[model samples]
Target: MKLKFLFFAISFLTAIHVFSQNTYVFLGSYNKNKEAESIQVFQLDTLNGKLTKITAAKNVINPSYLTVSPNGKYVYACTETKTPNDGNVSSFEFNPENKSLTFLNKQKSGGENPVYVSVHKSGKWLVNANYTEGSVSVHPLLENGKIDSLAQNFQYSDGSINKERQTRSHVHSAVFSPQFDYLFLPDLGADKIRCYGFDETKKQPLTETKNPFTKTDLEAGPRHFTFHPNQKFGYCIEEMAGAISVYQYENGALQKIQRINTHSDKIKEGFESSDIHISPDGKFLYATNRGKENNIAIFSIDENGLLTNIGYQSTLGKHPRIFALDESGKFLIATNVISGNVIVFKRNQITGLLKKVGKEVKMENVSCVQIKKI
Candidate 1:
């Protein structure tokens, strides 16, 4: 009887360990064919970096980007991308028990080609950046995970040095500050990082801060902005120049502190840097470069929030548009848009490097990858 009780205790502990190592990976893709699936859900094995398909959500056209709510109960996606004068932001209920997504409702995005969406930590607000129409929209999230109509809209008309790519304002990403009191929008075309104060209690929660914008270098084309884990610094990846601009962040204002190139000296032209993410422990940073240089640049952060480029890892696929690290910080997954595949990597926590692992998941034109622990 004693031995049987001991075995039962050990088995219970083992079951809990296995359940803790599972995470959900969400992939958003561009539906070139109208009947194709737009969003997919996969179960990621955090222990080995393996992915098993759970299900896919269809009927939404061009769900290019996705973001999960703070509670992990809902997912929001930007749909109908590149549709002239018509773009929408859709919401879905995420059921972790069954591992499926149910379509809730969608609202007009207030502009064309909504490329990015971010939810506030309170799960009360949702904001999106419109790439083609050069606008920003704010929405109130209902209690049932439905998105309210657009509460506020802002438009910008500005251009930078690049005549072709920077001819007009192209807001690429909308990110919330660590404190959840501000929102930052990285404008690729205007070469500026726009800031706004956020107050969740009010009807219109977005207000202009004292220092509204931080200007970038000429032709830099800032694409994505990510805050450091310590909340003392922020990093922006430039799409056109293949560089990262580091900033000292305080109360919605950004002061540039360091500027670093993400590529080697041998590569000269065709730099299309896409995504930026920092490790959970605040020790390392990683950025993805597309176009001619298809690699992920690895960097180490110091005590003063400065980045020192350590090395680069080939993505093993072409056109890595976005990559995400799981909540455990042990697995990193990247989506190759043009290559039509998803690659998983084993992350080294101490050295801050990535090793390709597991089999590649095939999904045509996958644009964004996000992981959430449920």
Candidate 2:
């Protein structure tokens, strides 16, 4: 009887592993002058948190930021450029059958140094944010998974308190609201979160909303923004100040509710916050901080959307530019740009803590990480 019971338990666990969906992860790197493949694809074993290389997408110039379509059939990247008004965005067809990417076409990004790109939920519009010139560009997605000409290009002129980093407007990210009715442009150099109404049904998809925009602290340098799963609150991670600002969002407007630091007071100087994300369950939030304190700050979100600091974990590498959690919320991957390595961590689901899984991949200046079920 005991032998039969043990056999049944092993069979049950094996069935669960076989039924789980296979996960695919894409890594983007800062490949200057096309020295290496800009994007690399890997397969992640959900049961054991193992990452195996699958393939790579080559010849993409500085494809620093990547976003997939709603259907996951296409992939888009921001081709970070140096020349003013010369940045471009590229589109690729993702072949799931063989796990390969084929280049489709590219479009001008309106401004230089395109740092961020996001696809609209409808999969009809692609929004890009240019950092060097502080501009936002919108493009229509063609039916063939390519990009149309620039639909709108809005330039910002204001500068904030930080003279070195905020000499002029520096639009960092373009994120859509929960319902897709509004878009938020976080400007690091202007100290403002610009809001706009989106209507893809019209000739022009984006228009300035009635509320216009909202302001952050004098030198907050709002870099990235994320909305809660409940859609009642929003959070902005400040790049220059190493802080997270909470807001009550409604009808394209933001009301600042609370602000919390991503790092402790002991490490006062040289704080450069990079990215922020919420867990799949929406109970936990994570933000990355660079500089002397190279770690990820973890927090728990209360019922009212307020945050309570929990703990911090070392990234096991330098300059963790960005990190993302898998769909199952079982694993987390971080791209260490300065160290040129990608590290994976196993997540404790109930306690919301991270443990290094002893897996790392060496690449050239890794910058971004994206995981999707294939």
Candidate 3:
């Protein structure tokens, strides 16, 4: 009895130590014609902010954007396009023990230049957005953690004020609401946030909502969106106009509350805003600016979900296309697509600011950063 009790105690403590030791980080990049691997895997040291490369998954085409399932058992990637109407989305089964991914299957994204992919809350549907062709598509998530088939494909035909950038439709992101009842597609060309009602029971997952869409500023070029943890408010980063739009969210409706600049007044001309994310505690917000300003705009969220500009932190690289806060909200990783570098920052939990952690990983055309605790 004494030996058995000691053995159980040792196993319990070992499990806890293993759980807190490592985090897996996955990066998606622009690898055209299988020139290089599309996805790179790394094991991040939670203690010293160091990343050790594990492996790379090749032959994935242009997986510019990726998302892991809620269960962390699978990964989904958007295979971007070189030609106009030939994009696809693929799935892989992730093995946590070996830190490897096995190719599952691929399916037509139902659009062109697929840029973003997201899985539904139920893990039963997958959605993607196509930039060049201005379309959105839904796919059924099979029981084996693979995407089975395209369920629905919707295209947008409207254009915004900018003639060159908004000549037609360019869907930038497809995000689901906090409740998972509706899906929002932000179209950069149309300058609107398109809404679709989601039904888990139907073969066709998405339908036009009652309030079909919400218009942004004529040339704001809404690109990425983030929702508050309380589900009462939301924010969108406008790519063209270099601003963030704050909104009060209820059911499927979004009422614009405020519009604020992501960059300061001095840096006015080249505003290529990229991504926005809220902290796990909902006390802070962060957005990335590209073009001439390669920095992250930090903001503090009030009790009412309003934002106050905190400050900015240089990303230490060029064209910070995507940035993400780790699950613990202790580290922030920014991927500079043009510079081929990933910069890591340590978070000040109290003040909601970031400082460089002195760890940078270099890769070719890195576009997406995602961290999962393993």
Query: Quick one: best lDDT, which candidate?
Result: 1
On a 0 to 100 scale, what is the lDDT of residue 228 in model 3? 97
194-275, model 1: which lDDT tens digit per residue? Answer: 9899999999999989978899998999999999988999999998889999999888888899999998778898778899
lDDT of 1: 0.91
lDDT of 3 by residue, 1-374 (tens): 99999999999999998766568888998878575878988877766678898877887888899998888888999985545568999998888678688889999998889988998988999999999889999999998998888888988788988989999999999999999999999999999999999988899979777899999998999999989999999899999999999999999999999999999889969879999999999999999999889999999999988889989999999999988888889889999988999988889999998988766999998999888875
Give model 3's clash tally.
0
| TM accuracy, model 3 | 0.94
Give the range where candidate 1 is weakest over 10 consecutive residues by summed lDDT. Answer: 14-23
Model 3: which residue pairs collide? none
- Residue 142 lDDT (model 3): 94
Q: What is the TM-score of each candidate against the true structure?
A: 0.94, 0.93, 0.94
What Cα-based lDDT does every candidate model obtain?
0.91, 0.89, 0.90
Query: Against the correct fold, how does model 1 do in TM-score?
Result: 0.94
lDDT, candidate 2, 1-374, per-residue tens:
99999999999998886576477888887887565788988889887788898888887778888887887788898886554457899999887678788889999999999998999988899999999999999999998999999989999999888878898999999999999989999999999999999997977888878887899998999999999989999999998999999999888989989999998778888889999998988899999999998899999999899999999999988999989999888899998989899889998988889998857899898899888885
